[model samples]
Target: MDYSGSFAQEWQNEEKEDNNQKGRNRMIHFRMKNNIGSVTVADRILEMAALALAVFLVVLAVALYHYLPERIPVHFNSVGEADGWGGKGMIFMLSALGVVAMAICSAAAYNYKMVNLPFSLNPACLSQQVTIIGRMMRVLSVLCGLLFIALMLMTTVPQWGMQSVFFSFFLIVMTSMTVVLIVYTVWIYKKGRQYR
Candidate 1:
């Protein structure tokens, strides 16, 4: 049917357009590897750390449940003075808080593709942002769980004292959080500039 003149050129143009559309579609549906949308090895390791911290908190709760006495030390002053007390039942909340923190973090981490709560949708920067933020969340979750575990353990051992236990806890948490956030911010900025 002599398809070598105007008709052939028309068919070629249509085929080119179809291929370009398919390529765009693929890009739209594609995800950046190792981002929050998918769990990576690093994420799994952090998740395990969180789980370990949760177990430690639970064991501490069980141990203290037997001998925590009627009153539990709930609050510590800036100088590490135990200025507030509550019922022994309240002590369990320290472990409970650890569990809840881990749950919240894990939920958010797994659903990053579904909902970006702490992040806005900027398709251009989304990939790098998700990668950085995912790691940040993992680290923070582990820190939170560990912090609660430490608090729960301190409640069990009165000899640990508010001065050493609470004060050191304060330093460790603040320092860890500060360093993590600072590094994440710098990482994001540098990556953004690189991609730019």
Candidate 2:
């Protein structure tokens, strides 16, 4: 009967449906964006905590290096004069290197948080890549601390020298881990370029 009016009514109905679909899409997009923002903030906090731990380890290393010798009396004349210097120096070197590696890792972590925190929350962000790197640094730090304790023990327990072979093996492992961490850091930086 009234074909023209009927066609106009049909067009209006289609337009309304399209508008509703667009509105739904916008809401979903906004929600996803908000969630990404939250993830990024959480990642930043984790990175900051890691950074603080790194700083503490560095300070501890320094204090141990300086204070240990003076605080403890060298009763070497009684026990064949324990050579604590070698162990202390080795530990000091390890601690210094650990500080450098941790600093690099912290900078990389901060860059990652700053660059990707606002846009998307990628699973790669929480991947073992960063965790492994951190663990590598931690292993090295622990080794240094252990060496410090060994140095103290050497003063009282001369027989601890029997375990030098084990410590040497761990030193090798530490070196290998350090190499892996350096390589991993480079790879992460390269991969993260796309995210940024």
Candidate 3:
């Protein structure tokens, strides 16, 4: 006689789980919808640029094959001196690794919108943050690719001294990445405040 009451209670429980006070259902739907939908033009362009940078590294590595000596410097010292050497073939591996890194970053950028962010906000703000993250990932990927390419060339060419090269490269790349992180932090702070 009370089976109907039990069924209604079960349904209500399920609804409550799906729809919390914060509109969990809406938040989830927004996340899923905007994940692929909110990709900005700049994000797409940067991702493509990352792919191109990888390809360029590969092509450049191949071209350098003829110029690189049988043994090339593989590692450098803090003072910009070569402390390690390897076969010329290893040059390709450097660029190949860079390409792989770039690919991973590009994938991350493409899927950044799907990542679980800590802050809960309106769909528009969420989309904006996602796009920013995607663009940043793409930019960082390109920077990584460029760094590898530069390293490869520096190691292969005899005229360019390794002195201070890595120091400069790391300083520049680290600075750029730090700036991105700072910007993202500020963005999250401001957007989070709006929701609070």
Candidate 4:
């Protein structure tokens, strides 16, 4: 058994493995490029707005933390009464939740092709679907951030017209999210059918 033959065979195998890895990297890059390229101006605006709202929530929580009471309302009953109390630190958690929502939406937008759909779609329709879904994710993120911020405000200053303010914001955000989800899902689903 010549050692040279075995060594050459091992080198060829290593080369093949490297080539396979490069191919995988290229595929990943292509997917990312396609997703990023498909993002429309409206999507970018929504994403930026979502990020800004999330950051604003964190800042608001920080600014009010010291002034807030040691124990604050952290939960409310269906009747709009505060039913659960927690330390002021819970306010920060609420803001952090907004940030988490923003991050999740960002991920979803970046991997729109991986989003689960109720119906099958042709490959050619993926780019358009990506744009639609990305916009929806960004819009949802913004709405979530607003809702969290409104909740934070309600907890921190229940007396300063916050209750009504928060309730209004809550209704708006919920309605907006519902509409966005329904419209985008139906739109994408219908467009996907045309492609098929």
Candidate 5:
């Protein structure tokens, strides 16, 4: 039973089959890796943008509060004729609260991004910490975004006579960005499952 020729040929065939399989596996893995990387990068960028918007809102609120009395229309009603501070003050407080909530949501998002970065850079090291933080941020962002929307609605709808244009523009930007952030958060969650 001198089976050298047949054995060699069989071995060669097996080797070729393995090589092809390995190539295909490598391609699939490479694509998955690229998707994970892209999703992680997108999440980070979204988190940063959220943070920046939060800060901008807070500052804008403060500035508007300081300048509203001297710069806005004060003759809307006779009740507000003597001093418009009450109406301006109410708007300022609600806007400030909304900004604060947005800031908190942004901070949570930043933490989520930070916790997940290691997993993105090296999926082998994903742990419970990242998963928990990511979930927490997703929940917090939704809640905060909702609260901000409510605050805007309560404060803007009634004051349409005074702040219609400004509130409308701000609401549009805030709502659009909030929706985008929610989508990004969901994407990150799905990608995180892949790592797990």
Candidate 6:
């Protein structure tokens, strides 16, 4: 009936549990590192699309430079009417802005480890969570490029007499995209929590 033997056995069980947890954590980390080496085809396509869009925006601005009016619409009212005008040079600035946004989002995706997620993630879920977030950033970058292209077309092609209709449609598209992104982000966060 000696108590020392029982105490020692309990301590060994605790140590074993600790070792098992450490091994699981190591496995998770290994998986994450392995994922970095294997870039998926989808990821490549998304990155390519974003880069192509950025380049297209710049080229479009340059091609339309001489043709655009000196005073181009820079702002729109609630009714989708051009309420503000600015120098045609603003088109280049708009294109540059889109490129900058694309670059930023791409950078964020590449450096997902640096991103400050809203919630604390379990170590076991870190790899999957970060990967999902990175992909989302890339998708958002592509969406931003599209939004800028739509704005440029609406402002530059006022002669079509379809600006208001296009503008209204653009707003709806923007809102829908935003909603989808938000829902996706929330889903990722919730899924991460399940791994805990």
Overall lDDT per candidate, in order of appearance: 0.73, 0.49, 0.74, 0.80, 0.52, 0.82
* Deviation (Å) of 151 in candidate 6: 1.1
Model 1, range 1-196, lDDT digits (tens) per residue?
6868989899999999999999987776664533454568988899899888888878878877887778877887776666788888876787888888877876766555633443344557767667666777788889888778667655655654444765687678868978987887677666656655
Q: Write the number of the candidate with greater lDDT, choosing between 1 and 4.
A: 4
Off by over 4 Å in 5: 1-59, 66-86, 113-164, 193-196
Cα deviation of 120, candidate 6, in Å: 2.2
| Candidate scoring better on TM-score of 4 and 6 | 4
Per-prediction TM-score: 0.73, 0.31, 0.70, 0.78, 0.37, 0.77
Residue-by-residue lDDT tens digits, candidate 2, 1-196: 8799999999999999999999999998775443322224545555555556556656666665654443332323323453333444444555555556555644444233433322233344544334433443444344444434443343323343444454455456557656755665565555555454
Winning model by lDDT: 6
Q: What range of 10 consecutive residues in model 5 has the weakest lDDT sum? A: 74-83
lDDT for model 2: 0.49
In the range 7-83, model 4's lDDT, one tens digit per residue, is 99999999999999999999998875665437678878888888889779988999999888889999877655688
Query: What is candidate 5's CA lDDT for residue 185?
Result: 52
Displacement of the residue 7 alpha carbon in candidate 3, Å: 26
TM-score-sorted candidate list, best first: 4, 6, 1, 3, 5, 2
Q: At residue 177, what lDDT does model 5 achieve?
A: 59
| Candidate 1 wrong stretches, greater than 4 Å | 1-38, 112-122, 159-166
For candidate 4, give the lDDT: 0.80
Q: List the residue pairs that clash in candidate 2.
A: none
Worst 10 residues of 1 by lDDT: 114-123
TM-score for candidate 2, residues paired by index: 0.31
Instruction: Name the 10 consecutive residues with the lowest summed lDDT in model 4.
Output: 31-40
* Residue pairs with backbone overlap in model 1: none
Better of 4 and 5 by TM-score: 4
The superposed Cα distance between candidate 1 and the true structure at residue 51, in angstroms, equals 1.3
Candidate 3 error regions (>4 Å): 1-34, 113-124, 159-170
Order of quality (lDDT) = 6, 4, 3, 1, 5, 2
